[model samples]
Target: MAAPFSAVPTPFRVRAADRWWYGNCAWDAFGICAALHVDGHIETVCADCREPIVVEVRDERPDDQRLLFHCLVPAARWWADIVFT
Candidate 1:
């Protein structure tokens, strides 16, 4: 007889373009921290272009917009609108 079924794992999906898409900056950072499960400043590369990516969680001001947005080139800037907002 076949074995009883169990809860199956679903595929984790992330768009290839999102790494460069400015709107997904938060999502990208969130994913990185979640993936590494680390604390403090983190330095990594963009998943798409391999450019440097830096994130820091520390004693900081909440009003800082730099924490969310980035100055991307014209191509990426086109998709910079915050999707969740």
Candidate 2:
């Protein structure tokens, strides 16, 4: 596990399309889950995925507002790359 607190901040938001791959299997999901865990906002990320194609995440927690402000921002370019490659 990473240290409880690190000198640098972790990226709270990441695009699904940035990580998405066609024919993605269990391994891919597991890898994504691990990455999300390190991000510290795991529950919100997972919850956003349960919806349709469009997903958004907004910070509801009062204390760590900065850390919680995240959304599954669309990565259209990444998705295009996945399709082309």
Candidate 3:
């Protein structure tokens, strides 16, 4: 078995589309994504086809965070049913 909390490998880093493809395989997948040293990182995908279409990231202001998203589908403005607790 591997160490409990080892650093993420370079090969493990993938784009949002790649991550979705590998993650939602015939089997199953879940987890988290972390940028090595980027700030205000955000990603989005089309809800219908589950395709990644947007990604925003930067190095300045690593602590600052923001996200902007919208859905093209009518009757729905947000892609996923986001509910902040």
Residue-by-residue lDDT tens digits, candidate 1, 7-80: 32212222222232122344443453344343334345665697766555333222234654444555445456
Order of quality (lDDT) = 1, 2, 3
Worst 10 residues of 3 by lDDT: 21-30
Q: Could you tell me how far off, in angstroms, the CA of residue 81 lies in candidate 3 after the best superposition?
A: 15
Which of 1 and 3 is the better model by lDDT?
A: 1
Candidate 2, residue 14: Cα displacement in angstroms equals 15
Which residue pairs in model 2 clash with each other? none
| TM-score of each prediction | 0.27, 0.18, 0.23
**What lDDT is reached at residue 29 by model 3?**
14
Clashing pairs in 1: none
lDDT (Cα, tens digit) per residue for candidate 3, span 1-85? 1211124332122233333222221111112223233232233455469766444334433223464334344435322532210
Quick one: best TM-score, which candidate?
Answer: 1
- Candidate 1 total steric clashes: 0
Residues 1-85, candidate 2: write the lDDT tens digits: 1322223333222233334322132222223434444221222223445532222322322233343323243445534554232
TM-score of 3: 0.23
TM-score order of candidates, top first: 1, 3, 2
